[model samples]
Structures are given as structure tokens and as C-alpha cells.
Target: MLMLLWNVLKKFDLLSLDNEEEIISHLRRLSDDENYLLRDIIQAYQILQDCFQNITYQHLQLVKTVVEYSNVIEMMKKSDLYSTYGRRRFQELRDNLTTQFQLQE
Candidate 1:
């Protein structure tokens, strides 16, 4: 599964896409796993697309922050060490990814 993900990411040139529909189509073809590692990547890409709609920057620190944050979140998604509280926090983060905390309590 991890290998499949790596292969997809190696060829995933989402930034060059000109339309959201094309991106969604590509994501749909990625994999059928519901909560796989791709979920975090999918949501992160969408949120970044929406939030940074007009920003154009070639900053190194920001790029590092995005990559590091995504890597840690992806690891957390597959980690089994989350206790009850930790699981809840993880869920909250997941929810925020899609809803941006607007619909979360």
C-alpha cells in the first residue's frame, strides 16, 4: 500500500492542473481505500487550493512547513499509538481538514 502511494505521489503533478474537476477525477482514480493515507493528502491539497487561491510565493520555509506537517499527519493517520484522548484529537484534526472547524464543536 505504501509503495502504491509512493508511486502515485512520484507522478502526482496536481499543481499543474487548471481545474478542480480534473483534480477530483485524479483523486477518485487513486484508490478505493476510505481512510487510507491519501485522505490526508486529498484534504490537504483541497484546503490549500481553497485557502491559498491567489497567493504566489516561492518561499522555502513555507514549503518546508507544508511538507513536514503533511508527513507528520500522514504518519499519525497510520499510527496505532493514539489513546482515547489522542484519538479524539486526531479526529478533530481530521474534521478540521474537511470542515475547517466551522462545523466542529
Candidate 2:
């Protein structure tokens, strides 16, 4: 279900390749949705991966906001989705973010 939504977003250039502000804004909107689901969180993680590919100060700030402001990570930890491919991808995002943050420090 969520994956389908991601594909649509991707088809429209709403995902990772879009502007950082746009992505962050979309994420913020998603986080605010009453029906926000695991797919939304997973999409955010995938966007983070995209942001990491072209690391910038703005992108870094977006990453920080997603990590610090959202419960996505904790949700991921609790979700059975973690047992699937999502888990590995989430871990990669986590590790990449940690490394990026450390290097910034």
C-alpha cells in the first residue's frame, strides 16, 4: 500500500531528487497526518538516503529534523516491517546519518 504511494510520489518527482525544502515540507506534512503510516516513515528514510547522496548544509538540517523531530526511527524499531528489506535499509540510513553527524562534529 505504502510502496504504491512511494511509486506515485517518485513518478511525480516528489521524493528524494526534489528540493530539500520540498522534501522536508512533504515530510512535515506526512508527520502531521492523522493517518500517517509505516510507508510514510519508510519513504522518509529513503529520502534521507537521497539527501545523503548530495550532502549539503540544508540537506543535513533536513536530516537532523527528520531524525530529531520524528518518531520514525522508534516506529521502525517497533514495526514488523523491520524484519523485511525495510530493516536493512533503515539500518543503513541510521548508520549513514550517525556517521554524517559525527563527521560534522
Q: What value of lDDT does candidate 2 attain over all alpha carbons?
A: 0.62
For residue 52, model 1's alpha carbon misses the true position, in angstroms, by: 8.5
Query: Per-residue alpha-carbon lDDT of model 1 for 21-94, expressed as tens digits?
Result: 55445555444445647666776467445534655565434544555477675677677437787788778778
* Span of ten consecutive residues with least summed lDDT in model 2: 1-10
Clashing pairs in 1: none
Write down the TM-score for model 1: 0.23
Estimate TM-scores for all models.
0.23, 0.29
Q: Write the per-residue lDDT of candidate 2 for residues 1-105, one digit (tens) a residue.
A: 333334334433445444756775766677567687788778777775664455667855665555454577567566645476778777888999999999999
Error of 1 at 80 (Å): 7.9
68: Cα error in model 1, Å:
3.1
